[model samples]
Target: MTFTLAIVGRPNVGKSTLFNRLVGKRLALVDDQPGVTRDLREGEARLGPLRFTVIDTAGLEEATDESLQGRMRKLTERAVEMADACLFLIDARAGVLPTDEVFADILRRKNAHVILAANKSEGRAAEAGLIEAWGLGLGEPLALSAEHGEGMAELAAVLTPIAEEMAERAARVAAEAPETDVSVSDEDDDEAVRKPTRARPLQVAVVGRPNAGKSTLINKLIGEERLLTGPEAGITRDSISLAFDWGDVPTRIFDTAGMRKKAKVQEKLEKLSVADGLRAVKFAEVVIVLLDAAIPFEQQDLRIADLAEREGRAVVVAVNKWDAERHKQEKLSELREAFERLLPQLRGAPLVTISAKTGKGLDRLHAAVMRAHETWNARVSTARLNRWLEGMVSAHPPPAPGGRRIRLRYMTQVKTRPPGFVVMCSHPDKLPESYSRYLINGLRDDFDMPGTPIRLHMRSQAEKNPYKDKKNWGAPSRLRKHLDKPKPKKG
Candidate 1:
């Protein structure tokens, strides 16, 4: 029963500030520079009793061509079309410029529900602009200062009736709907009883170097041009998330900006964008490192994929633009070899070949993502792990450091979701990194966990003792001390 509200305005008009206030978090990147935001970012907005989805969109620009600004304008217009209401914000200090008038007309024609507001209306200097905002012909413009948290109560008051009206309309529609009878078989009833409750959506992130088709791939997967895509290298500047259903599985997919090397990321906005993308990778369960097939596995691509592996997320390397390549088999072979050689930590990970433009090979990509997720969450039983440890230790015993054998005692899985294990062995500090890698590789191979990072830790047997650090050595309990006292009756 919730509605969606989109905050629309030119660049540097406090849209992001108001969005952060409503969401109660700094979800969007805000800066004094114009066009800091380039994607449509959605967040759950809470304003008093009214709850709705709020989309923070790119600024409205006067461009119709296929330039970057034009594409951004198109994206913002799309948001306007989808949103239930549009909050048209104008800078009060700057007053209503020609750009503001142009976009106001655009919103008037595109969206029926529009709330005009004059932002930065906290001083006498803004009085003229506040008075001028009414001429836009939408309605009475509220004086708002997003930075100072003014006029929020008025905004909430305006939104309350709209929310109530929508709710009532929805309830009336439900009441008018006819009821249908459904028959359930005994097997169906049993199946329903065995079904698990609804769970949270799976998180997936698509990351790669500039012009590697990350946005294009996501748009193809979602079956819509929801994201702004072009031949531009850095068209996206925010890690935008969209909720979608991938074949019965609820998923939240993140489309991140292209991440260049540190030296090339000199611009403040680009650096912020890269940091935001890195955050997305850390939050995701499975990460798809998209690479251009023409030049697959570049240094930056390897670094991005390695970062995902280091973050302990499931890694899926996808070579995009396969349809444009002439020799598919040869190119794919080269990609596989390069992947295995360049990123040994993510050994045996899924390397999927996809054509993001033509929408070919997405099914394989989806399968690989699902498989990697399953392997990442794989857990082995304690008994099986111990037995496997025995075989591994017997096959190649631990190296003797200082002429002393490092005895391996037991092994057990400590956690899953990237599958962590702890092995009890003598002189864990003496265990070599090569030996740890050997054990981790063995675990991966034995448990059918491929491409998922595995954490193997060693612990000494003494560390397992519960009373190792008890005070007063082996002092008796109070009751035992009283019982052991001299027998006064016998005396």
Candidate 2:
């Protein structure tokens, strides 16, 4: 691993701007708003010849209790502990606030290697604040203009030495390490390392209507207030991904902004946030369509679930705030009925109940997600598919058009990952939608595919031509008959 640097500061002090500058991309959402970044976002930072891993953390607030800002502070402190060095940025324009001083003392107590930097130091207007930053007792502040691309060379100059030292240490460790071989074949071991099974973290996105506690659920699952949450709706604007293990299963969960109905989402920012949430759903293999236990399935919720189904993502419907429900059994049953009736496409998919605030029923949700992923990627041998197809056709024959049934001649699995199938037939188009649904249901039941989208493609046999194999196309019928008769004369 490269040397890790953590940029810590109070809210809106250009921490994210510097992060974006170092990473050479606008990864962290930046605005004039304070505390825009409430989670620790890491990026591979490259400046000049120096390269290292940099973490942009939430603003170091003075809240040391169970409040939101306190939790945010705790997250930032955790970053400080994990990183090799800390870049303590103070807004030179608004230099050296009490919170910054308090945060500085905390860093000192933690014994973290600290690099003092004063951001927004562009002109004489900031000179007084920049000078004041020197008294923060960390070191001579590296004057920085993160937004305007100024003081970057000086900042790089300071970090280059540390980067070089880290590289040397890493090289030495690698050189000293002994080479060993596993008992298993290299290819098999490699496959075990990188495949979707358990090796790689499962990408799961939690999406739902605004105020459905999606962010709260993710935060509860991670066991840290890693995301910003409030009583207000749509607290999360950006789709933030956090990595953690769920019951020994590595997982990456994205806490997305709650989606409102498109008609109601008139603000440009809301549209972007909703778009980002949609993107997270598409990027994810498994999406947890969260619903408020009290409100249950709204029209917007149905739309979101349908979108996930259309995207061919494995789905789990989670009713959040289950602890607040008065009649648990009845609510669960009601939720089930509604889920099936409203989102028929995701019927038989896991509909779990949980309180993201209290972290209930997460294990069941976890299991369901894993199962859905497996179902989504399920495959069947062509022989087995054909066998199943024969039984299905026998059970309910395709609709006969003009007193002739549209024969399903054969079936084969074209691919997996949402389980696509191809059926060769006499007349594919003659197969009705209801019949196709029947076949799909049969496939689902016979193959035990649950809560996963299934694809079916139909190909009709080529029409036969009477003269397709003829040798002499120009020959008249009389000449052809005469030629056949001459063959009898020769005999």
Candidate 3:
């Protein structure tokens, strides 16, 4: 609920650099490359005593409808509408271009409160270019250098008053708000709140390799050109989150940058983009790892699926560009084989084939996502788990190491949201990895938790009886002491 300020301008004009400076972190990927940011990324920004929300948007570009740049422009305009103020940046070193002049008017028409800044105004050489920026008719431009940290005090002076006003309003509203009390049930897990919320939107992140139609899929879902899509690869550089409803379920979906192999990812900017996509996976409740149907289950795709599994996220494999495939049956077979063969760790995950461009098979994908989410949050009672454990162990006895039988005494469900269980046994270390997999697979099948990650830990303990671990197995008790007093030896 903080005050929001958005950085707006053409590409490669130090907008992201300034955003990073204000946020005090390298949250956005910054490089000399133009059009690196295709979506708006939000962060909590701080400059001196001023604190507010900051958004970094894609550059303003003019293009026809259905084109990528045009879509990016539309998204940026949406950001302008949401922000309290806009910092319109012009590159002083490059001087004002025609696009800058055009966008200056656009910002004026689009937003009421716009602050103009001439960035890269660090050295004397930029003075002439800085002077030229004033001709755009956005009042006198604030001379600033985003990279060199100059003119920040001036920027702070202008923002501090605004920040203070926002703070006072927020405090007043909070003070007037009423408080409510609610009871938390003891039967439910304490971390139930951490699981996916029913009232809130379902957070789903669609991520995959470059040009796999991630943006296209999101655009199809929203029935608008909400994201930029093109034949070009690596168009999406930020994990853009959009909110909408699928059926009755409100959903928040993230279209992330395509993940390439670590060897192919060399640029500092791309590395940051990949990291941002990875972060989206961690935050998401259900992650749809999109794949190119024409060439599905590539090495990178396997790695992405593995990463999601390692994070314990509910996974759905979505093969995009399905309409482009020539051999439908053969391709489907190939996808299935490759998915199960390459990513065995994510066995039984939903493999949904869809054409993001044509909007084909989306319903199936939606169903799969919903199913995976339900399974991820699924829980089983301790009595049920213990009963199932006994049946499983009786069917396939655990390995007897060194003639000592590894007795699995009992098991209980420890948690849900990727259902975790702990099994009490003798010599837990002696339990084989294969047996652990067997138990996990059984849990998945018996509990109807397909595609959801399961955690099982074997903990060692002695027999539950109080005298089981006690010494004196051959010694007589007090009640039998009189009868056993050397009578056997005398006979």
lDDT of 2 by residue, 1-491 (tens): 47999999888999989999999987777777687777678788998877798999998887888776877788888889888888999988886788878878888877457889989999888899888887889888898999998988888888877777778888999899997644664456532443454446789999998889987888788887667677767667778778898877788888888898888999766777788788888899899999988788888989999999999888998888899999898878887887778887776898888878878898888888888988887878889888888888888778889887788888888877678999999878877888888888888887899779998989988778888898655589878766666454563
The digit string of per-residue lDDT tens for model 1 on 1-491 reads 78899999999999999999999998899889998888899999999989999999998889999899998999899999999899999999999999999999989999989999999999899999988998999999999999999999999999998898889988999899987645555455532442222356789999999899999988988888889999978988889999888876678899998999899889888998899999999999999999988888778998999899999999999989889999888877788788888999999999988999998999999899888887877768899988888999999999998999899999999987789999988899999999999998887788898889999899999556566796544566876666667778863
- Return the TM-score for each candidate structure: 0.90, 0.83, 0.80
Better of 1 and 2 by lDDT: 1
Backbone clash numbers for all candidates listed: 0, 0, 0
Cα RMSD of predicted structure 1: 5.7
**TM-score: which is higher, 1 or 2?**
1
User: For model 2, what is the alpha-carbon lDDT of residue 486?
Assistant: 42
User: For candidate 2, what is the lDDT?
Assistant: 0.83
- On lDDT, the candidate that comes out on top is 1
Pairs clashing within candidate 2: none
Write down the worst ten-residue block by lDDT for model 1: 189-198
What ranking emerges by lDDT with the best candidate at the front? 1, 3, 2
lDDT of 3 at 184: 61
The whole-model lDDT of each prediction reads: 0.89, 0.83, 0.86
Show model 3 residue runs off by greater than 4 Å. Answer: 1-5, 22-25, 44-53, 61-85, 92-99, 120-132, 143-200, 325-330, 463-491
Best by TM-score: 1
- The TM-score, computed over Cα atoms with residue i paired to residue i, of candidate 2 is 0.83
